[model samples]
Target: MSTCRTGTGPLTAAELEDWYAVPLGRADGTWVRAGLVTSLDGRAAGPDGLSGSLNRGSAGDHAVFDHLRRWADVVVVGAGTVRDEGYGPLPAVPLVVVSRSGDVPARLRRAAESGTRDGPAVVVLDGHGEDVDPGRVLTEVASRGWRRVLLEGGPQLLGTWLEADAVDELCATVRPVLVGGDGPLLVPRSTSLRAPVGSTTHLLAWEGDVLVRTRLR
Candidate 1:
């Protein structure tokens, strides 16, 4: 996870702000970027059923996570992740829980209610029977001008989006550990991690971990 290469390397304070001040021009809908981590052997979760072990207190990775959160207008996640990760309220952004039933965790609901104007908005993909139509979700979000969307996901949800050709980009960090469970599957759209629909570009290497971005359809 050393300095392999970088399109935007040496992510300094100035670089972090405005994504190295690269002006990613606007388009028709929301720009969806996923933030995920995996082990060197490719497992999203460990024996504990969470990504914490893969991270193992990697401050650089955590900083990247925070930066993604700050960069997004809304944070979208799957319900299973909310339960397994035991999430609470976010700082100043709303959370969108993509589910067939559109049911939210009680804690998350309470957090949404007790917080500032930011809250949770439900988008039920009942038409697809638990298969979230990410396009519809992004369309809804984009209509509201929440164009910077971050999908912090459970693999299944990301897999669904990936299959639907909905993701705009994927930002990932590959840690040095190798876990045995399911091998950090980024998007299970296919049987294996295929070449990204577009291409994968290295962002930077941080704290013995590799950060990369993949442009998607």
Candidate 2:
């Protein structure tokens, strides 16, 4: 990985991979990963749902996001985030939603259908692993044979996965800006874990006052 000064600049695909990709060696059947962009002050959201405050990077960050989305077999997000972000399905990848409650919002259903021709698949994670019908949801997503799941979250969902110890790797972008408000942070506090979580820094590029990628240790 090469080091560039922190400011606005362009980043290449190679630079993106060097920073974001953290090999887990393929033993963990469920590869739960997160991609987040945050300001220097640690704000994850602006007044609106968009992370525009942190999108100061050159075209490189956009390319990186595209690559990450394409690489994953399935994209997983919380119900709240899906509604807030107005996400659509990817061309080749399937979409999965992890909801404790079986309830899915109306807008999400519409967005999912609009993104895919067949339809979008929903996965509800019942706390008891019972009562809810997993088979029905799996039928849609499983048909595509998606083994790797990419988790894109808005703090709360990411914190849930971390508390469950289900996350295998983390790919985070730390930007150099401070927007302190009643907004969300990159990662929420984990009540389940007693010790501090650690990560190894893999500096990809320095562009537009942002540091592209770092791996969870």
Candidate 3:
């Protein structure tokens, strides 16, 4: 992780390992966390309409992002994010999908079906009729023996899961830009937590992004 040059340079592999090792905090049974990036203006993405755009010039954010992904057992995400970001196959971990119309994104669906080097592992939870049950989705992930679940979201999905109390922790990256728009917030304003939440606890800052690690109260 030496190339992460910016805020902290030449970081040791042992340091990153120790930092992200217990990132999700203490886990009673299952460890679930959402990893998303936001700008200073609180927009989750820029005009490009993708969070990946947040780390366009800086590879530092990407290095940390990839590190977190590598530590995850499975990635949980919403269908909208899959469509918007054009999700592909995850290397080793399976994807636990949450879709409304049971529509898996074309790119991911094809990768799972074709069975290429992209790796074939995609599980779209039946999110038809009503909203997808967050507990049920977590249960499915747990059933697969996935202890560390990394949730990548598109606001709405995060809000729902947060409301459901299925989320164990949140890892958000605050970028240095002020992407102004009606762009998505870290959590959609339309959805609220079951109760009022407070400020997020600061974990660490790397490069130009601020990392916040907190559990729902």
Candidate 4:
């Protein structure tokens, strides 16, 4: 995968890594980062109701996505995203999925059962309703020494975290394509919500796609 380039010039792979490197955890404290890709019109997913379609021609988005995963100690995702994306176990980093039913996906379970080299292990954090407590989820991963948290969300999960002001950073990829649909936005709609204020940390582009990293203090 190629590194992201600014409008002025291209960046090397190491430079890109430095821009997206995981921040060090302090004394069991976690740095929560949410990674999301959306279309030009702010649709989190395309017409198919999946984020993958929105990533069709965004190689730079994919590059950042992979880098975020690799740099994280563990990947935290909602159960619906796991099912919708047909997620398989990761090769290295452990995956912590939030599922209400406490049921592990068959594919993930199969990898665990066979003890294959398919990916790292999966831990299902059972929640009560449509989502789980963001703090609880973070605590679970932090307990396991996985403090560099990467949230690959499906709206509700991300929204909850954003509402709670638990997200420390946000890495958003905006593709040039416009997806007009009832798809969810980066943050769930809330009229009375106090959105977190963030500072732009890095902005990079590649193949007409834009990657923005924001730091929320």
- Best candidate according to TM-score: 4
Full-model lDDT for every candidate: 0.69, 0.59, 0.74, 0.78
Candidate 2: tens digits of C-alpha lDDT, residues 95-194: 7776666456664555544542443354434334332233433344445676566778767777766666656667666666677777887776443665
User: Largest lDDT belongs to which candidate?
Assistant: 4
| Poorest stretch of ten by lDDT in candidate 2 | 129-138
Please give the lDDT score for candidate 3.
Answer: 0.74
TM-scores for all candidates?
0.80, 0.72, 0.85, 0.86
The segments of candidate 1 whose C-alpha lies over 4 angstroms from its true place after superposition are 1-10, 18-26, 101-103, 110-129, 189-196
Model 1: residue 181 alpha-carbon error in angstroms: 3.0
RMSD of 4: 4.4
- Give one digit per residue, the lDDT tens place, for model 4 in 84-116: 888888888988888866566887756655666
The clash numbers for all candidates, in the given order, read 5, 5, 0, 0
Candidate 4 Cα deviation (angstroms), residue 200: 1.8
* Model 1 C-alpha lDDT per residue in residues 176-213, reported as the tens digit of each score: 78777554475563633345375654467776787777
lDDT-better candidate, 1 vs 4: 4
TM for candidate 3 is 0.85
